[model samples]
Target: MRTSRFAVTVTAVLALSALLSPFGTGSAQAAASTVSPTGTNNWSCKANAAHPNPVVMVHGTYGDMTVWNTMGPALVNAGYCVYALNYGSQATASMVTSAGELKTFVDKVLASTGATKVSIVGHSQGGTMPRYYLKNLGGAAKVNDMISISAANHGTTNTGVTAKMVGYPTCVACSQLMSGSSFLASLNATDETPGTVSYTNIVTSYDKVVTPYTSGYLSGPSTTNIKLQDDCPADTASHTQMPSDPAVIRLVGNALATNGPAQATYKAKCTW
Candidate 1:
């Protein structure tokens, strides 16, 4: 699981890597790579038959919809009707709230697009928190595929301390992120991937956030966990950068391109 940190933690690696990242440098380059589509952000945009499900971008803690500034446009350019949703204030609210809000937003998306199901691509809390909707809130009936980037699937203590020592949960969702919170225990009581939904989780080895990032791995049928470095050994992106990483984006783009057979896993050609 990736760190669900709301505040940006500037590490020396993150700073230096940003200067050399192949994904692009600053906001100017980011804008250039994420080309806008004539149909982007239009709720009425036609959904391509190849990518039938409308894609929804979910942001992490303390993050708003703008977090998808880079990826959102990319999905749009790929002929997907993409929408980004912001949940929780500073993202401190409970997963219950997150689930409800997502359901409402998905309902709106389906109504607007006349599609039955939508695909999801989430980061950090946005990645892990949605399980509640799928497992308990009837989202399994709504979502087709879920792709998580640096998500905290099994829970994480990114603060470098146990949840108990941190004086318990800082908020409702925070409790679930604790290593042994009741919320987590209940969440894992059954299959991690439950339903007809296909899932892919992406993680980076250099993440200082989601301690022991392997905690992000998902187990069950139709679920795949991707280690970004495995595909590109030279990749140096930090946890916060996963959503915008080129390698990560390539995998997402391929997965959504399900021509005749949907490939659950796709490897990127190492370019770093």
Candidate 2:
């Protein structure tokens, strides 16, 4: 079932999200200002009343917040107070450890901005691990929205092999991403997307990390599943390229327009 596709400009997307935001103060200053990538925040920046929910960018396994360099500034330029953190950076770090890190960082964002909640933008393991925090570590109440790019949600296979046989003793996170892993099983045991937290999964058919791409799909109320090539058949964005892929960026922007940009899905055409 195909629906109408509208290519709303990024500015319009942010504007719409702001309007539907629970924190917009209708101030001209916050709605239009931009944050430099090197700007000193120290969490001192106040949440834009128009878009009060600060956005926290989480990185994937063996990756850090620097990965968001391409996407973070874009959000800041769009008038959002952006933040990013590195979790599960260690090979031995359990998913619970990363989830705890997320909780702590989220609390800091809330307190720093004096805001009650935040929106999460995670990539790869960045996307997969947060759900554990939300599902088991009491994170649903703090997150307003979650946008996962290439998440290992339902678990994936290791080069067509199951986790049970993939050198599990070395990389804990790797084992967890495989299908049938106890970590993944318990993570999906309850409602995948709980509360009013809107969930969006931006996956790529060219994904090699999250094999069988379908494993990344998240289902729940207000949850949307977007295949980078579904609408743009020409798109060849790989799992590693999603953060910088123009098409993926736009899709994420539309998803962030949670309040009232009825035109969230856009027409995309990318080649090579």
lDDT of each: 0.67, 0.67
State every prediction's TM-score relative to the real structure. Answer: 0.79, 0.79
lDDT string for model 1 (1-272, tens) is 01111112112112222211211111211211232222345777655666689988787764556566555665665568888776765355788888889889889998888888888888877888888889999998998888888877877766442232221244567666767678877887878888888888888988766667887788877877788888889899787787767677666766565531125445564332
- Compose the digit string of candidate 2's lDDT tens values, residues 1-272: 01112222232333222211110111211121233233223477787667778888876654555556556655665667788765554322578888898899899989999888888888877788989888878888888888898888987775332222222334467667778889988888768787777888889998877777888897776788888888778778777677756577666666665662213356543421
Best by lDDT: 1
For residue 244, model 2's alpha carbon misses the true position, in angstroms, by 1.2
With candidate 2 superimposed using the best TM-score fit, by how many Å does residue 120's alpha carbon deviate from the native?
A: 0.4
